[model samples]
Target: MVDESMRAALRALPKAELHLHIEGTLEPELALELAERNGVMLPWTSLDELKRQYAFENLQSFLDLYYQLMAVLKTADDFRDLMLAYLKRAAADGVRHAEIFFDPQVHLGNGLDLDTVMDGLLEGLRLGRERYGIGGGLILCIVRDLPVESARHVLELAAPRAADLIGIGLDSAEVGYPPSLFADVFVRARELGLHCVAPAGEEGPAAYVTEALDLLHAERIDHGVHAADDPAVTRRLAEEHIPLTCCPLSNRRLQVVHDLRDLPLRKLIEAGVTVTVNSDDPAYFGGYIGANYEALAEIGFTYDELKALAADSIRASFLPEADKRALLG
Candidate 1:
């Protein structure tokens, strides 16, 4: 149960979720529902068994199961239900705004078109605004482990609908497909009016963070926990006010860091780098945005620090300036 003191604090605060993956929000119950509706056969018969698989030796292990679950999501309605479920939980956790990521490669591999995925996601987001009053945006991320040509094709598709697609990001594994591999794709994305962001410093080195900024022109860095490795890069990021969307639990779960307290979060903040805590994948990573805050707070961040983190999330988001001000104010 949520503690009374923490519950009050969590409810009253306005939060912006900066690093969630829309597909990663697929809870087991909804997975079953979608599977049944689509007549898809899942390998697991029960939710308990599915939850057990969440334990991971590394990022690759978890990704295998993550991709396996995608088989159940094949239609527009499945995507809508996936997003609507996340929105409901996020609203309950006081998420005022969210910049959600979705991998088009995964959906397209399942024979789903970009329009189908966008239609469902946008429909759910519209319903979220009307019903839950949540402000949110979409970031179509490229699965970097795939061919660069695939990323280019996705970017080409996103260019025409650039208004709906606010940003482009790099997700999937970070070790092999470093930020430099997607240099051309990110350049085109930025030219087409899409903000560029990428996940580095999880399993990758500090060099990847530098490449994300220099080569990919990433506006923000996701999972930048290892920036502390290089004093010069850390100072440069801080000096430029580049925000780092740090996912505390995802770091711990993926073995990016030993523990929450062991994380360089407080250090990153102290170093002048803007840091925002987020639930990278609520269902797969174990909690929602409020749970992420609660986990960090338990490790001893002060109320003012929590507020700063919340504000940083909004500042790093792609929300319209007016909406950003309203959320922060």
Candidate 2:
């Protein structure tokens, strides 16, 4: 069991969230509200019914439900309200800084325009900073399941509002769609001076993580727990101090690990890699970043270990070092 002291320690430390999906923050209650507002009829009529569906057999199982709920997100207010709601929860959980991932390609597939998605999320991020004092930015994702031209089109749209977005990422199904598929996408984003990160080695192989680092030149790896599967890559990640954004709760919900104790935090840490805990999808997988820390504590994480993870979080973030130090203080 996690003691109150361990929980308290985690709550007191301000940390950065580096692996969150903005859409994954959509709670069942908020989903229902948005559905009603947008005049959409959801298959799950009640909140409890939707909650029951949150349990997933695997990553794709969860993605199906996650994308289905997003049908209600038709207006800018829906998106802004969604962001504010998540920022409030994150702030309450002691998130002082965050880099949120958004799937604009998925939104576009839903027949939503680029401006509506970007404008509302940027507005909500602005409000999150003003209202919650939570420093944040957006990283638009390229869905690997889509064609390269679709991603290129999304990038073109991103160019106009490049100032509002800080980075580009590859998300959605990772099995067949390798990081190498988006190599040129990252090259263009890097040329435009946007930070790059990729979700790899979670459901895919550790080699994919190396591909992301070597080919895509991703600054950080999201849900990189499976990188522990490769000794050489793991060692290099340790020696090079590559940050692996680990999401424990999401791993369990997605059946990445059958047991919370088997989450591989210790192995990654022992290998000398800078591992930071985050809530990939709070509402669906259950719990925010604080609860992720508490889960680690329950599995034998000490106060110092928790502190180090918190520190690693800020260091891995896109924030300036001076700002990082201030947040650290």
Candidate 3:
């Protein structure tokens, strides 16, 4: 077990959260509050009932509940409150910077305009920076399970506010919807001067990692644990210095690995791959970024090794070079 002193030390390290989903940070208490405020009818009556559905057998199971809970977010204040709440928790977890993810298409489908979503999230970011000094931007993630045309449409709608985003990412169900499917969408995003990142090899094959790099021009691979399955793919990641944003607790909670010991974090590190720890969906997965570091420590990562992971997180972030150097020092 990790001691209090060690946990305190881990929490003191300045880090950047690279794979967070703002919607996934909704806590049960806040969810109920928003439901009441927005007058949205949820199937679950009490916070206890809502909390019970956090158990998941797979990615789809989690997403089903994830999208359902989004109904409470009907106004600008709701979105702003959600982001501010996440930033507050992230600040306590030593998040010096955070490139947050938000699904605009999903919000749009809920009868909200793009302006409302962007305005609220940007306002939240402004407030977060003022309050906590945490600096970062958003990565508008494309829901891969939806129609490719919908993916294209969101990119089109996002073009006007491209400057507000740090990057574009491919997320949601990863198996059948390969990176190759959104090749055009990513190309357009690049034209808008956006960085690229995609979730590959969590539930998909290691080949999906290659496709993300080659086709989508992904700068980082999210949940790339499966890349270790192929030496060639792993070698490319190491040689290219492409980072993997691995969420240990999320992997275990989602049954991506039956046990935390089964995660390939050590193997990936030894192979020269740049791996950083993060809390993909902290609230649902049961930990924040600090908890991820502590879990690694519990599994035998040394103090210096954990520190190195913290440095990796800052290095892998989308922060400006000078800003990154300042944090690294």
Model 3 CA deviation exceeding 4 Å by range: none
Report the error of model 2 at residue 221, Å.
0.7
Tens digits of lDDT, candidate 3, 172-286: 8888899999999999999999999999999999999999999999999999999999999999999999999999999999889988999999999999999999999998998
* Candidate 2 clashes between residue pairs 3 or more apart in a chain or in different chains: none
Least well predicted 10-residue stretch by lDDT in candidate 2: 54-63
Q: Write the number of the candidate with greater TM-score, choosing between 1 and 3.
A: 3
lDDT on C-alpha atoms for all candidate structures:
0.86, 0.89, 0.92
- Top model by lDDT, which number? 3
Clashing pairs in 3: none
TM-score of structure candidate 1: 0.97
Clashes of 2: 0
lDDT, candidate 1, 26-101, per-residue tens? 8888888888898999887887887777765677788988898888988888888888899999998888888999
* Cα distance off (Å), candidate 1, residue 141: 0.5
Q: After aligning candidate 3 to the native by TM-score, how far in Å is the CA of 62 from where it should be? A: 1.8
RMSD of each: 1.5, 1.3, 0.9
